[model samples]
Target: MTIFTLSLFSNPLYSQVAVIVHATNQQALTESDIKNLFTGKLKSFPDGNPVIVLNLPEGDPNQSLFNQKVLGRSDAQVKAFWSKLMFTGKGTPPKEVTAEEMIKLVSENPSTIGIVDSAAVSDKVRVLIQH
Candidate 1:
């Protein structure tokens, strides 16, 4: 399974992932900030506004890359982490949506942040970083 997963990511088409937010957000984020947001470490933007993290549904290739590259965890590990957080009432995981839906959500909501395949980024959303 690990070999197959590695091979899927080895494809050049999936080589880059972009972190994005509403164009109006205007907040610069480092990779660490992004990791914090997704892991429930940093709950709000630096300016104090609340944030909503978005993720592609489990098992999506882009989602796998985002989890591994950004969050440093596998899909099941992320799920278990969030489950524990939710069980203890410490935090909730990012809401899951399809890629198309993620674009729409991030474009419509200033506080919504997500990652997507670099090729899918559009004018509606601003790229914070590419990895």
Candidate 2:
């Protein structure tokens, strides 16, 4: 039983993460959409609604995972990318918030979207995609 318990704890399948948006948002997003939004490539939903993107504060585990899985970039790389964009007046990075704050903010704004650990997801937001 101890060995079985250890195996369960070590399983990679447990590390599920989700991309979320306000429950009222009806736009369906693919992996590319999520990547583009987070990377400052796509500024609006496919339906033409303006988007508000949120990120977990730097060094947070969920932020790391989302950056790796969705953006295919590291935290430092993301920062550098945003810095260049900001310096050039080309684009702005997403707003950073705590995981708890993200839940509340995304829930309140119909145009907002964010990524969070699957365990933090609740009924207030809709799961747009899982990674």
Candidate 3:
């Protein structure tokens, strides 16, 4: 029999995740920028291109963390917020997607921004911000 050791620290999945956007998006985004984009406050990038915000499905761990830490809203709060906006005809909610789907969407659309675990980042996508 052989014994193997695996350190938690060595696991890449255990590493901290970085919030990313397309590098072509020259606008340096602050935490507020990210929040505003997702919440539909700021619709255009600094250069005036339409900005698209992608989000994970509700109840996802990363989505929950991102909502709490980045957007400063609980699941219910976000729901209510979107409801108000939609009913008012002011704005539409961001596109919701699975973690895997978001990765593909953000990468393919330069105007789109989405959050993903750092471990999932690939050469096909540009990681503009890591927060």
* Top TM-score prediction, candidate number: 2
Tens digits of per-residue lDDT for model 1, 19-114? 999989999788899999999999899889999999888898888888888889989999999999999999998888999998999999999999
lDDT of 3 at 84: 98
Please tell me which model should have the higher TM-score, number 2 or number 3: 2
Alpha-carbon RMSD, candidate 1? 4.4
lDDT of 1 at 104: 94
lDDT of each residue in 52-100, candidate 2, tens digit only: 9999899987788888888889889999999999999999889999988
Residue 1, model 2, lDDT:
69
Cα lDDT for residue 82, model 2? 95
After superposition, the stretches of candidate 3 with alpha carbons farther than 4 Å from their true spots are 1-17
> Against the correct fold, how does model 3 do in TM-score?
0.79
TM-score of 2: 0.89
Q: What TM-score do all the candidates reach, one by one?
A: 0.87, 0.89, 0.79
Native-referenced Cα lDDT, model 3: 0.76
lDDT of 3 at 96: 82
Q: Ten residues in a row with the worst lDDT in model 2? A: 9-18
- Tell me the deviation in Å of residue 58 in model 3: 1.1
lDDT, residue 38, model 3: 86
